[model samples]
Target chain A: MNKTINPLSRQIFIMAFSLLMVYPVLWWLGASLKSNAEMSSPNIFSKNPVWSNYIDGWFAVPNYSFTHFYLNTFTLIGGVLFTTIISCSLAAFAFARLDFPLRKFWFAILLVTLMLPGQVLTVPQYVLYNWFGWINTYLPFYVPHALGSGAGGSFFIFMLVQFMRGIPKELDDSARMDGCSWFRIYWYIMMPLTKPALVTVGIFCFLWNWDDFFGQLLYINSVDKYTINLALKLFIDTQSAMPWGQMLAMSLLSVVPAVIIFFFAQKHFVEGISAGALKG
Target chain B: MNSDITSSSTTIALSRKPKRWESPLAGYLFLMPWIVGILVLVAYPMVMSFYYSLTNYTILDTPEWVGFQNYSEILFEDDTFRQSLKVTLLFVLFAVPFKLLFALVVAMLLNKEIRGLSFYRTMIYFPSLIGGSIAISILWKNIFGKEGFINQLIGIFGFEGKSWINSPDTALATLILLVVWQFGSSMVIFLAGLKQIPLDLYEAASVDGADWFVKFRKITLPMLSPIILFNLVMQTITAFQMFTQAFIITKGGPINSTYVYVMYLYELGFARFQMGYASALAWILLLIIAIATALVFLSSRQWVFYENEGGK
Candidate 1:
């Protein structure tokens, strides 16, 4: 009975601590559904929840609903994922499966780049993009992916390389024996087998791109061109009235897509993170 | 350490010495995108930015090289430069330690074999997923505003709570709290590290009737030191580069208390059109980060445990 007391209290502590950790998120949701008058009440639930806040906040800004922003965000994310997965897999195939010139040298460069912080690249990348007239457009984000430098896409490539190396070479050997070209093997055999790693990379790319506030804020300027993250900021920075309820409502809703994705892909997301940050 | 990353990741089979007909063309095609991206996006800017850092070019005109003038000015003349550095350093000092401490603690808690583990882990990690979004910053503003939930809660006890994110005294602390709240990534890593610690060590400790604290001190911590160092270096670098929350929440004011280094760089590069000056600032930041990283690496040799070296 005395021994049970220790484990019992420990379990209780974990439970209570878990609630404390999650209360802010729940409160965020509840606040989104609360009236302005009821905001200062401090209780998470309102006497009468306002479902209208979502509607009101969705269309808070003029001439454009949050629908446009959500679409824009998805377009950016979809493009990034498509390019990142395709290009990273391509590069990973080269490093992992194929023998090439300067393979070790280039691989070394990628490894060295792992330590170079993104902030160092910001100023010059901005200047170069500006020279190419890419600012205030999605091209700044898109072109990088096509070139295979889409934010941390190189890290994605490195991770995919690691994942690919783990796959049995016998599969590649047999596939080659069956007269499969390198590209075909990479596409059919290697890619299919790397689904878990690809999922990890894809989820992280989505989550990171979704919440990439600074990068988005730097390039995107026109209101019509704004993503959900930029739009939420627009609601506040441009407002004199400062619609706290509407802003909070929109803010809460803005996080849903990312939060939902994360909740679903938590395992892959965590795995991807470790593969990139730790194993490297 | 330089050898650490490449040694593990780059060890691929080189046994297939292909025929001359099996040309390197296809592999180059596979790698072309990254090569092009690196040359165009990464390498070009890195080199040009170094030149830009030496010049006095506003975006309006061609840059004129001024031979280390901008660097010297920042080191000697710039007041905001100094202030922002101070703010950013303080941020790194306080936020990184506290955030890592929470991560280690929470990681230790969840390390125990318990039921419903995933549920707790998910809930704790959820904050970090959305924590960097503008939406979360806006939520933080609401919660810390004068008439926000916090003040309202304290109102019942007849205690006045100041606007936390608005007051210079507490604004940085508010940002630190937010960083600490987003300890999910570090927590996840720490959890992984804890799992890697040999179960036999714990079994042996218990067999000897060693208490939890003593065992954790002698066994767990020493084993986890490498991971701890990694987190410390990574978190410190991240804390230095922190911008979004400060940019949105404070916009670097209530008297520039939150005017962090990145904010200053953004202002110099974009708002003031002093791209040349901003480039110099960015380089200095890189130098500082390099020094800090080196210091951490140097210090690591003393305390960081490597099992290959028989740390025990």
Candidate 2:
């Protein structure tokens, strides 16, 4: 029954379908180089490309450039990455290894939070953050992640916990016999061994926090503090007849970091996702 | 001196007393941040959110208590709420199944022992990595705009195309298409699950002269049900909370055809500063998600095959 389509035909079919899947993205690349006049034309790319789109769009936002937004984004991502790695790995280690009171209960809660919609907490969390005077600052972003409750923070911990469980218990016992403390075992032994999972968590933390437009839009209101996402959204709101070519140019730039990371660390991402699904 | 040191170490080992790190307090110590997080960030806010739902708390004034008023008005009187709910439900219903179906089909095709497998996987999965950014949403808007690439392409074929995003009939469809476009991550998960199914099972089926469809039905589907359930729940919850594309691409526009639940909630809470009403909406959203998830789980017992449960 399967021989209806030979292997050679199947390969051709997959190749064609893959091209169709990424067709829009390819168009996006070509369109970003097109002059505004060329936008309506059916040609993917213009002969004389307008390179000014990226340069102009970079400084299009008044008083603040893309540089400022990129800085804000990197700063936010850096802090979130650090905090998520430290906090989530600790929580995962504790859950996976430690025998504490109510461990199962808390672990179950972590699993529940993995599926809970973030919208439920938005209104009151806004109020709470407002009360703390954190509405216009990055503290709201930082504090939750530091405490292992940010977006996908629970899932990160859950993933790490699954990874840590696969590690033999004897390693911990051997370290303990050498007068190593639990913290030491986690820091010295478990962290190094769970490097793959930690890298996965870091990559996810960076990507999710970067793409979190809603949270950034809600919190960082001022121009100077705007992230790349907020800046992009602002670019649209401010421009009545938006420079399509310029807008496309900047949008392409905006996704570059994520694309680069995905390509560079593609293996970890695939493994991380597979592990999270199968093991969890 | 060496013998003296050895004897002391032996004594220490013989005692085998629990180290300070072995104590239960260490566990709490490790969990302290998350504990504080759940209380301050999750638990307290959830309770306060419920309270705010019952009040007339616009952020400007002190929260005036009007118990159940917000809930009553929303449930009984709101048209936009119902519209948003319908749009959201339709979006989820269409998007999740189509995305999963595409993902599974592609996964099956790529599961073969083919050359350039990684290349195909990478190209297909690339979209999902950056799909959620505002940039992609902006790109989507232009792609479906009046003079966008799609319309232009169709025009060349003598098939007239309208501005898809600006039409009420097609606005939500474009959004669903956007969601369906990023089926890469699900495809990856499905691919992994596909690999885990024992080759021997397929080989045995072949020996019995079973066709591809029979092998797939009796072997692949049962083994992969759990992953299917996982993808279903994740994608459903995600589809329900979809805000960025609707907010940016369509702005919930063309007569609110794309106004999702969260967009409505966002308008009420953030734009109009109706924290109380928005909180009510938020609670209902939570309820909807919970029921939906529970329903999926309940339904899964009938379809999802658990190996540990001793194969039905």
Candidate 3:
């Protein structure tokens, strides 16, 4: 069937299908600048673009704005990224290189957790965090990740371990011959050598945590501490006569960070997905 | 003095003590955080969740031992639990296979020698990266609304457009479409898997005068079976846990048409404060997922082709 179509037609078909696939997003971009009056028209672009929608939407929420939400999200993501990289890398290194009792057992547990669903743990974790007085704070997000127990943390460790294992053990031996401590070798040799994997891990961590609306909604109850996700939901609930343009504007902005990161690290991000899936 | 130093060095050599770097303590130190994490976050919570499933505790009070009452109620008595399960299973049934099929088709299209292949892949895969956000969910909800984008677009063609999301018949379907729309990650995975199939196999098949379908069945299907299994298991597991879209889109509404299992669990635990009952619901979900995953793996024996097995 494809041969009958010929390569030129195939190219055109693929191109057309690709455009159709992203048509919604293109429409979204065009609609963000559309006023509410033009919203029901079905036209993607309007004669007069409403650029003020973004400005108005930024400060639309009273007392706190998208600025606060953005900061909260960043602060939370920053801590999570730091913790996940450090803790998962360490754990991966241990699994990749070190010999210890129950090493297989621990590694097996890590693999199991990789498939374990978050819903199974959410309630008990909520109760646990409540006991520690970490409710309504970013600690729940940070602390679990700091220990490689956050969402997809085991997967990160697994990816890193796979990458680290590819590195020759001879490097560690040479570093040891130079009287470098295990920590020193891990920091100086293993970490730098596993840069590609770490970059992959970091991108995934940022994207997943950034898109973790459910976890954030569960823990963050206060508007002041709301991430961009929570605030968006709040925007919906608070607005009686929903300003389509403003909502679209803010919604567009909400995805901008992810889109920007994705565009810049497009290669690593794609490689990371394929690597994790194929390796597993 | 030289004799004394030589004697001391010999004594030190005779001891043969292990170096600090060689000690197992370093390994333990490196894994300490993860160990603590497993114990505190995963292991403990899992055990507690199981225990809570057996008890009746609403976070405001002490958990009282009820000995399987919650499970019995959910399994035997609760209509909503059954409804939620049915809805969720339906959602999974429709979403996972459709999503995988779509991904595979697109992957095959992109696997060919085409111009701007990377551009196409990037454009197609970008949505999956941020697909889970509340913003996208909101976008979906509105796009399918009565007066929203979809209706307006269809109106241009002179077709009657209803509130697709608010209607019971199409609500779940709309959500499935949303899930399928973000088929980028799976497509990329499939594309990668496709690239791994040796070109010689196809060349040999072509020499045999095998048509496209035969070639796909004999070469592509068998080779890609392992990846299909991977994508299948992963997508099924995720589909079973579908929440944000359902929650925001229909709110499990149009008279509970889209009320998924997690939405029911969320309502029970967070809204009604029936933490114990919700814990029971959660355990059942885990069981369902585990069984579903295991069944897929078990079924793979007949279908999934491992290259190293050499057709034996």
User: Model 3: per-residue lDDT, tens digit, A173-255?
Assistant: 99889899999999999999999899999999999988887898889999989999899988988999988788888988999
Interface RMSD of 1: 2.8
Q: Give the TM-score of candidate 1.
A: 0.94
Colliding residue pairs in candidate 2: none
- Clashing residue pairs in candidate 1, if any? none
lDDT of 1 by residue, A79-103 (tens): 8888788888898889888876778
**Tens digits of lDDT, candidate 1, B115-213:** 899998997888898888898899888888887777987899999988988899999988988899999899999898888888999889888887788
**Model 2 spans > 4 angstroms off:** A1-4, B1-22
Model 3 chain A worst lDDT window (10 residues): A1-10
Interface RMSD of 2: 1.5
Model 2 lDDT, residue B164, Cα: 99
Top model number, lDDT? 2
DockQ for all candidate structures vs. native: 0.58, 0.62, 0.56
Model 3 chain B weakest 10-residue run by lDDT: B14-23
Better by lDDT, candidate 3 or 1: 3
Q: Considering the true interface contacts (CA pairs under 8 Å between chains A and B), give the fraction that model 2 also has.
A: 0.78
